[model samples]
Every structure is written in C-alpha cells, then in structure tokens.
Target: MSRVTVQLNGRDFTIGCEEGQEAYLRELAGSLDKRVSEISGQVGQIGDLRLLLMASLILVDDLKESDRKIAELEGQAQRLRHENHGAASLQAEARNELTAHLTRLAERMESFADTLEAAGDDSDGDGGVPAPDTSLAEAGA
Candidate 1:
C-alpha cells in the first residue's frame, strides 16, 4: 500500500491506495478538493464537519445520477431486444403462412390435372378430336 496526503479545505488528510494506483487516487483527491473549495468559498465560515457532509452529499448525487443514466441505457437495450424478438417471431409466422398457401396452390393444380384427364377421355368417346392438354406442369407430364 501507498499513502498520499491530500489537502481539502486547508486540511491535510492521508489516504491509502495500491502503489500503482497512486495517480488515479491523486486525481480523485484533487477533484474532491476542488469541489470542496468551490463550495466552501460560496458558504464562508463553514465548519469542517459541515463542509465534509456537504461534499459527501455532492459526491453521492453525482454517483446517483451516473447510476440513473446506466439504468436508462440498460432499459433501452432491453426494449430493443424485445422489439427484435417480436419482429423475428412475426417473420417466422409469415413464412409458415406462405408455405401453407403454396401447398394449397399445388393441390389445386393437381386437381385441375385430374379434371383435364377426364375431359380428354369423354371427348374421345364422343368421336370428337381431342384438344391437347398443354397446361400440365413439367413434373406431372
């Protein structure tokens, strides 16, 4: 551990941090001191305890605002995920419906083939020249 002395409101305080984290700790301390000085200057003749309490309140408010922003972003992400899920489900349902409709069309084409075959047979019995059944699909032909 390493110790750093930080002066806030004209008082020196020592805080501990890991050796490599000195720069970050120092920067954090500097920022806090700046905030305290800014506040103390506006509210002159403030007690040390009251000054610290006010600083704590300011820091806590900042933390809370950061947390609130994070929560809002998380909610946005979840809503987007929900919308994507709904769209995917709708696409799947559409594909299934299209498949069913195509199958029905194929069945109707097969029924038409049977009717044409019967009509050809009837025409032959009546001694009429049978017109060609040119409408047969390649697969059925």
Candidate 2:
C-alpha cells in the first residue's frame, strides 16, 4: 500500500506501487509527463475530459502499433529459429557425407601409392637399394 506523488505536465498526482518501486514508478511517470507535454499542443483547447480522451486515443494508437511490431518480431524470430534448425540438419548431413567421401578418397590414394611403389621396386635394377641420407640431427649438441 505504498503511494508516490508524481508531477505530470505541471500537475501533481499520486500513484500506487510496491513499497520499493517508488523511484521506478516516479521515473516512468516523469517520462510519460514529458511525452504528454510534448503533445499538449495537439490536444487543442477542448475541455479536460476531451483532451484526455484525445491523448488516450493517441497513446492507444501508439500501443496498437507497438503490439503489431511485437507480433511481427515474434514471427520473425520463430521463422529464424525454424530456418536455423533446418540449416543445422542440412549441415550435419553434408558433414557426414563429406567425411565419408574423404575417407574413401584417402583409402583409394593409399592403395594407389602402394601399387606404384611396388611397381617401382620391381623396375629397379639394383633390387630395392636403400637411398643415402646426409642430414644430421643435433638434438643433444
């Protein structure tokens, strides 16, 4: 049962909020007051009720647009999530297929290399003579 005094467009009013939320409510009221003041010129010289109704209409119109935007954003987010799921599935399938293809290629290459080495060994006159190496390792030096 906490109440706070807020001044809106030079008029003082009381608002109720939870005990600890007075400052937040006051700030919200301050912003609303600022907006109301900014739009006062358009309210015309009509009576207070009429002016309030006009302002309320404008606020409601803005809220309607906001609601529409929220719905649009929600739809977009849902669509993005769905597309991401589809893309993830496609990527997983592509990755599996590529992995299988690479494995097969590697095995084929290994087999071909073994066959070529065997053929070269058979063609050598000095049967399978070891090649000389002049490289030196300096691990301990």
Candidate 3:
C-alpha cells in the first residue's frame, strides 16, 4: 500500500492506494479539486459537503453520457461490419456465377469446334465438294 497527500478545497487529505498508483490518485484528486472549485464559484462557497455532492453528481452525469455515446458508436460499428459481410458474400456469389457461366460457354464452343472437325474429316479436305474437275477443264481448253 502507498499513501498519498492531495489538496482539495484548500485542505490536505491523505489517501491510500496501490504502490504504483500514487501519481494516478494525485491526478484524480487534482481533477476533483478543480471540479469542486468550479462548483463553489458557481454556488457562492456553499458548504464543503454540498459542493462535493454537486461535483460528484456532475461527474457521474458526464460519465453516463460518455457511456451512452460509446454504446451508440459500438452499435454503429457492428451494423457496418454486418453490412460489409453481406456485401462480400454477394460479391463472392457473383464471382462464382460468372466462373460457372464462362465454363459452360467454353464447353459449348469446344463442342462446336469438334462438330466442325468431324464434318471436315468426312470430305477430302475440300468441304465435301469434290474439287471442280480441273483436269477436264484443262483438256477442254
């Protein structure tokens, strides 16, 4: 345990805290003293107890507001994450569909090429039409 002396409302008070937390305690006391002074100035040096209570209430209210804002921001972040996940899923689905479509198109093209090859093989490489009788034409000439 560590002991720390802090001044608040122009009075010194000793507080106990963990060994390494003296500086942190002093910092908190400074903030509280500032708040108390502000309250005293506003309410014209009301009793110490009354000033302390008012300062504590104000601090609690501020804390509550901060907590509410933090929760709202967390909710917004979660919603954005969900929306992003949905968009990613949609993109993946689109990619998969495109790949499948291209695969089918490629298969159809290959089938058409095979059919043309078979037709070509049935002829003397002249598209099944005998070459015009070039020798006969030459004889006539």
Candidate 4:
C-alpha cells in the first residue's frame, strides 16, 4: 500500500492506494482539486462537502456521456461489419455464378468445334464426291 497527500480546498488529505498506483492517485486527486476549485469560485467558497458533491456529479455526468458515445460508436461499427460481410458474400456469389456461366459457354464452343470437325472429315473420305479444289487459283496463274 502507498499513501499520497493531496491538497484540495486549501486542506491536505492522505489517501491510500495500491503500491504502484501512487502517481495515478495523485493525478486523480489533482484533477478533483481543480474541479473543486472551479466550483468553489462559482459558488463563492461553499462548504467543502457541497463543492465536492457538485464536482462528483459533474464528473459522473461526463462519464455517462462518454459511455453513451462509446456505445453509439460500437453500434455503428457492428452495423458496418455486418454490411461488409453481406457485400463480400454477394461478391462471392456473383463470382461463382460467372464461373458456372463461363464453364457452360466453353462446353458449347467445344461441341460446336467437334461438329465442324466431323463435317470436314466426312467431306474428305466418307462422301463419293471429290473434295473442292483449294489450289485452283495457283493452277490458273
């Protein structure tokens, strides 16, 4: 345990805290003293208890406001996260759909190529008619 002497309203008070928290305690005391002094100035040196009470209330109000803001920010963050997750899912679904479409188109093109190849083979060997002359231009020249 550690003891720290803090001056508030021109009075020194001893406070006890954990060993490593002496500095933190002193800092808190300093802030409280400043608040009390401000209140005293406004209210003209009212009783120490009343000044302290008013300061405590003000501090509590500030803390509550801060808590509310933090909660609001956290809610916004959660909503944004949900929206991003939905967007990512939509993108993945679109990618999958595109992949399936491309696969089908490739299969169709392969079938068309096979059909054309079969027709060419038939013209060359399976039919009784002679193949069309591809070298007619050269022969004339």
Candidate 5:
C-alpha cells in the first residue's frame, strides 16, 4: 500500500491506495480540488461536506456522458464494418466479371493468330499470293 498527501479545499489530507496508484490518487484529488474551488467561488464558502458532495455529483455526470459517447461510437463502428462487408462482395463480383471478359478476348485472339499462321504457310516464298502466269500476254506486247 501507498499513502499520498493531496491538497483539497486548501487542506492537506493523506490518502491510501495500491503501491503503484499513488500518482492516480493524487490526480483524482487534484481534479476534485479544482471542482471544489469552482463550487466555492460560485456558492460562497459552503460547508465542506456540501462542497465535496457537489463535486462528486459533477464527476459522476461527466462519467455518464463519456460512457454514452463511447456507446454511440461503438455503434457507428459496427455499422461501418457491415457496410465494408457488402463492399467487399461487390468488389469480388466485379473481379469475376473482368476475368470472364479477359478469357473470351484471349480465345478470340488465339483463333485469329492461328488463321494468320495458316495463311502464311500456304503463301509462296515471296510472302505474297502467286500472280497469274503472263508469259503469252508479254509475248503479244
């Protein structure tokens, strides 16, 4: 255990906490002192008990508000996760469609290449279609 001296309402008090929690205890006391100061200024030297009670209530209200905000943020995060799942499905579908289109295009290109190769094989060595024999026409000219 550890003991910490903290100032609240202009009075020093010794408080006990776990060994590693002295700093935390002091911090809480500081916050409480700040709240007490604020209330004292407004209410003009109220009793210590009343001042401490008011500060405690204020801190509890703040805690509740924080909890509410946390809950709201968690709900929003869950909704985003759900939306992302749907988006992932849509992306997969798009990928599948693109793959199918590419497959068909590849098949058509292969067929065209085969046809060109066949034509090239049938052509004469000059890489062109054979011209008609013109020997008789040239003799007349």
Candidate 6:
C-alpha cells in the first residue's frame, strides 16, 4: 500500500491505496477537493460534512445527466443506421429497375437493326435501292 497526502476544503489528510493506484486515488481526491472548493465559494464556510455532501450530490447529478445524454445519442445513432439501410435498399431497387429498362431498350434496338439488315439483303447494293431492269433498257434501245 501507498500513502498519499491530499487536501480538501483547506485541510490535509492521508489516504492509502495500492502501489500502482496512488496516482488514480490522488486524481479522485483532487476532483473532490475542486468540487468542495466550488461549494465553499457559493455557500461560505459550511461544515465539512455539509460541504462534502453537497459536492457529492452535484457530482452524482452530473453523472446522471451524462448517462442521459449518452442514451439519447445512442438512440439517434440507431435511428440513423436504420435510415441508412432503408436508403441503400431503395437505391438498389432503383438500379435494378434502370438496368431492366436499359436491357429492354437494347433488345428493341437490336430487333430494328435486324429488320434493316433483312431489307438491305433484298435489294441491290446501292443502299437498298433496286437495280434497273436490263429488259426494260433493251426495249428502250
């Protein structure tokens, strides 16, 4: 065990802790002393017990408030996560719809291209224009 001297409300006292925990104990004492000092400033020179009680109450109130804030923030985080999942689902649905539409459009374009190619095959090579009949030319001659 290690002994540490701490001051609270202008009085010095010795406290004991494990060797490695001396610093942590000192830190806790410092926090208590600071709270007591604040209480003293507000309500001057109250007895030691009353001062310590008021400081402890204040610290407990602060701890409760911090816990409440943490819970509120956690709720917000969960709600945001749910919203993000919904948005991602919606985006995936939209992409699928767009992809299906594009595939149908591509099929229609390919059918049109096949029809044009068949028409071209049925005519002369002059861009689907028929050739002049040789019998008609001979008759004219």
CA lDDT scores, all candidates in order: 0.84, 0.74, 0.86, 0.85, 0.86, 0.86
> Which residue pairs collide in model 5, if any?
none
lDDT of 1 by residue, 22-124 (tens): 8888788789888888888999748888887898999999999999999999999999999999999999999999999999998998787777777776675
Candidate 2 lDDT, tens digit per residue, 36-69?
A: 7756766645554555566678788989999999
Each prediction's TM-score versus the true structure: 0.73, 0.66, 0.83, 0.83, 0.75, 0.81
Off by over 4 Å in 3: 125-141
User: Whole-model lDDT, candidate 1?
Assistant: 0.84
Higher-TM-score candidate of 3 and 6: 3
On residues 1-141, what C-alpha lDDT tens digit does candidate 4 reach at each position?
888898888999998888999888888989999999999888888899999999999999999999999999999999999999999999999999999999999899778656655655678575764544547423431
Error of 5 at 67 (Å): 1.0
Highest-scoring model, TM-score: 3
**Residue-by-residue lDDT tens digits, candidate 5, 67-93:** 999999999999999999999999999
Q: Where does candidate 2 clash, by residue pair? A: none
Residue 107, candidate 1: how far off, in angstroms?
A: 2.2
Q: Which ten contiguous residues of candidate 6 have the minimum total lDDT? A: 132-141
> Per the 3 Å backbone cut-off, how many clashing residue pairs does candidate 6 have?
0
lDDT, residue 86, model 1: 100
True-structure RMSD for candidate 6:
9.4
> For model 6, which pairs clash?
none
TM-score of 2: 0.66
lDDT value, residue 105 of candidate 1? 94
Decoy 5 TM-score against native: 0.75
